[model samples]
Target: MKNYLFPHIFQPIGWIMFVLSLITGIAIYSSIPVFGAGIAETLAIDSAIIGIALGALFIVCSKERVEDEMTKSIRLASLLNSIYAYVALLVGCTILINGVKFLVFAVFNLVLFPIIFVCNFRLEMHRYNKMCEDEEQD
Candidate 1:
C-alpha cells in the first residue's frame, strides 16, 4: 500500500511546534506571571493543545529520509506499540487517579498516543540505524 506521508522536511517543523507548545502549556498550567496580562488561560491552553496535536501529527506522518520496507515495518510496529501503551496508560489512570487529576489526564490523553508513537518510532529507527552502521563497519 502506498503511504501518503508528509515530506521529511516537516519533521523539524513538527519538533519546533511540539517544543514550543509544551513550553507554553506548562507555563500556563503553572500560572507563569509572564502570560498573565495578555491572553485568557483557557484559550491559551486550548491553543497549546491544538499545536501539540498538530505537531505530533506532522512528526508521525512525515516521511523518513529513506522510506524503505524496513522503515515501513518499523512504523507499523511503532503504531501497534503506541496503541498498547495507550491502553495500559488508560487502565493505570482509571485505576490510580480520580477527581480533577483524572480529568487532567483525560485531556492530555488525546495527544498521548501520537507522542508515544513518535518516541517509539524514533528509538526503533535509531537502533536499526546503529545496527546497520555496525554491520557496515564489520
Candidate 2:
C-alpha cells in the first residue's frame, strides 16, 4: 500500500468528506471571524478548522499497521498524559481563572494533544525498533 499519513477508506469518498468537513468547520468558525473584518483579514483561521484539517490529514496519512504491544503502550501513555493535562487544568481552575488565560490554554491543548500523541507513538516505535535490532544482532 502507498504510505499515507492516515488511512483513507475510499480515496474519492475520503476526499469528498475531507473537503466537506473542512468547509463546514471554516464556515462555522468564520461567522465570528478569524483575524479581522472585511478585506483586512487575509487569513481567518480557527482552532476548529485546524482540528478538521488534522482529522482529514490523519485519515489520509493513517497506516494500516496493526496495533502491537508497544503501540498499545504508547496509546495508553498518550491517553494518560491527556487525562492528566485535563485534570491539571481542572485543578488550576481552583487557583484563578482569567477568561483569556483559560481560552489560551484551551487552544493550546487543542493544538497540543495530537502532537503529544504523535510524539509518544514515535517514542514507542523507536523502542520497538531498537529491541528488534538488538534481537537480530544477537
Candidate 3:
C-alpha cells in the first residue's frame, strides 16, 4: 500500500515548480516592456500555475512522506534566496542612502529562487528521504 501510494503522492513536484520558476523568472528579469511595462501576463501565468501547483502539493503532502518532505526541503532553500536578496538590497540601499526599486528586488528573487531550488532540490530530497529511512530503521 505504501509502495502504491508513493508514486501518487510524489513525483518531483517541487523540482517541476523550480523549473517553471526559472523560466518565468528569466521572462520577468528581462523587464523589457512586457505587455507595455506593467500589465503583466507573466505574473498571471505564474500565479495561475503556482496556485494549481500549491493545491496539488497540499493534497499530496496530506498523504505522503516524500511529497511533504520534498516540498518543505525545497522551500527552505527558496525562501532563503528570497530573504537574502530582499535584505541585501535593503541594506545596500540604506548604506548608500539611495532609493531602491521594489521591482529590482522582485525580479532578483524571481530569477534567483528557482536557480537555487534547481541546484539544491534533488540532493536535499534524496538526503531527507534517506534520513527518514534511517530513523525508521532505528
Candidate with best lDDT: 1
What is the lDDT for 17 in model 3?
Answer: 58
List TM-score per model, in order: 0.91, 0.48, 0.38
Candidates' C-alpha lDDT: 0.87, 0.54, 0.51
Model 1 over residues 34-138: C-alpha lDDT tens digits?
555555766778778888888988887899889899998999999999899999999998999999999888878877777788899989999999999999999
In terms of lDDT, model 1 sits at: 0.87
Better of 1 and 2 by TM-score: 1
Residue-level lDDT for 42 in candidate 3:
56
lDDT of 2 by residue, 24-97 (tens): 55464446553456544433345444644565446334542564455555656766775676667656763677
56-103 per-residue lDDT for model 3 (tens digits): 343333334434545664656745664676567567755655346655
Among all windows of 10 consecutive residues in model 2, the one with the lowest summed lDDT is 1-10
Query: Which candidate number would show the highest TM-score if scored against the true structure?
Result: 1
Q: Summing lDDT over every window of 10 consecutive residues in candidate 3, give the lowest-scoring window.
A: 1-10
